[model samples]
Target: MATDLRVSLTDRCNLRCTYCMPEAGLQWLAKPDLLTDDEVVRLVRIAVTQLGVTEVRFTGGEPLLRPGLPGVLERCAALRPRPRISLTTNGIGLHRTAKTLRTAGLDRVNVSLDTLRPEVFRTLTRRDRHRDVLEGLAAAHAAGLTPVKVNTVLMPGLNADEAPELLAWALDLGYQLRFIEQMPLDAQHGWRREELVTAEDILRRLGERFTLTPEGSARRGSAPAERWLVDGGPGTVGVIASVTRPFCRACDRTRLTADGQVRNCLFAREETDLRTALRSGEPDEALADLWRAAMWGKKASPDLDAPAFVQPDRPMSAIGG
Candidate 1:
């Protein structure tokens, strides 16, 4: 059974990355439509205590935008067989909230930062908060969020040339670096296969500047990233080639959206509703059953290379990636 649960606290975000959403932003979920703090905690309790979830990752368009984040972490920490908690954020307000979150049981963080250039950041995100993200990363590291990961997506004509530069920066700062191949989860549905920068392209670019020996698949299990040792030593970098080197067969995650819908896969078009049952006063057992049913019905991973492939209607922001 899947033990890692990705829970979205909210659909709200401060930055408007070109790949994520329109500049005007998406239709925000209504207040009542979102699960209350108590409701969120209760569902987490059920997932951990009843359904075998061991790790909970808080994700969002940017999870830092959630006001009750620290409180949510505190409650989840109080659970028996306490889970390993982490957050995936844009690193905008993390500088202010890192210590509070660490105190509330968060173990680590993954910050999305595609480029090191301030101008490139503004161009990509349509926001001028690049320095804020850098500061937030520093603060997160100082606050003891070890293995602070940086997720970078290389857009063909944008930051693709900076792959080696990005890796060197991460290595210098003691941050774990991961380069992800841009998938078809963008809102505009403008992703063309021909424009994609494949995993080979990334590795070849980095190879010119550094020696990256494969860490091998013996320890890879359900994790998505394929690791490589930098200079054949302690420091390492990862590449998540979701399209070219899909690891969906080994995926061990179940996703819960901010609105309490259970998603079986990131690309799944269907979601099972737990919010309705949750608000209707259904027992914890009933909620767990619904979740179980959802996972049981998960479809096989999509073959992106096939002619039949169709992107999900929900973008990464809506799906909480």
Candidate 2:
């Protein structure tokens, strides 16, 4: 299995970051409405065994919100061939959980950090504890999750000006940094086309300070970021241009929502209700075949790169970042 599986631990978050939770507060998915631990494990197994999945990423409103997240990661590690297990989070509660999570066999983590300015971070994430997130990054590093990746969403007039400094800081802190384009995933969250920081513009700006060596063309399979390393900077930097330079043609991954719906594409409006199918007694084989169907339906090119395609209704955060 070479595909990647994203398992949303919960639709709960501690920080209502502007780009993610726009309503000032989030409505949590009901306990019964969200997938159980067993359900997630079964779906992951099927994804690996049937879909030839090679990597599994745990995400969420904040993955650490899920009770016993480390245990879930351990179970995923126990899978045969041992798919590369990682997690993506906002780094709010990770300071205390990093050590245990790493010992449980979680291989990597991507912490979301947008601005270096404390006041700006507060405005961008709607929180004032920017220092806490920095401390969390320090703890994550201390926990020995080598090369922890940092995710930065660039929205012009917001955190866009902080890119160079953020990259420099991440390099100094020994973390991989990724700048993601602002997709029209949500409006109240401040996603607008004019406000977007395109990949070309970002690269040009960064190129002024550092030389980016081509990591060569991305090989098909499970990489979302088009990887790059600074010529002399500390760690690596990657760019995920879902809107500007969509790599949809090479997108081999699919998402399983917190509600147990499997979406063939992040830009998909409709999803197959796997929870209902599972409740109806669909065999594991059928469930696996359903995944195959989802992959087969993947667009040859991403909507951002295509002339026209179905625009998804849900926001990116709702799809597990």
TM-score of 1: 0.98
Q: Per-prediction TM-score, please?
A: 0.98, 0.92
What are the candidates' C-alpha RMSDs? Answer: 0.8, 2.3
Clashes of each: 0, 3
TM-score (C-alpha) between model 2 and the true structure: 0.92
The true-versus-predicted C-alpha distance at residue 1 of model 1, in Å, is: 1.7
Evaluated against the true structure, the overall lDDT of model 1 is: 0.92
Please list the C-alpha lDDT of all candidates, in the order they appear: 0.92, 0.78
Off by over 4 Å in 2: 187-190, 218-222, 232-234, 300-302, 305-310
Give the C-alpha miss distance for residue 117 in model 1, angstroms: 0.4
**Model 2 C-alpha lDDT per residue in residues 1-321, reported as the tens digit of each score:** 238778777777777677666755445667888888888888898888768888899987788878878777888889997899888988887788889999999888899888888888888777777887888888889998767999898777877777788878888878889988877666254455666788888888788888887575744234778776698433568898888777765666778888898887777767878887777789999888776776676555555544464446666666776
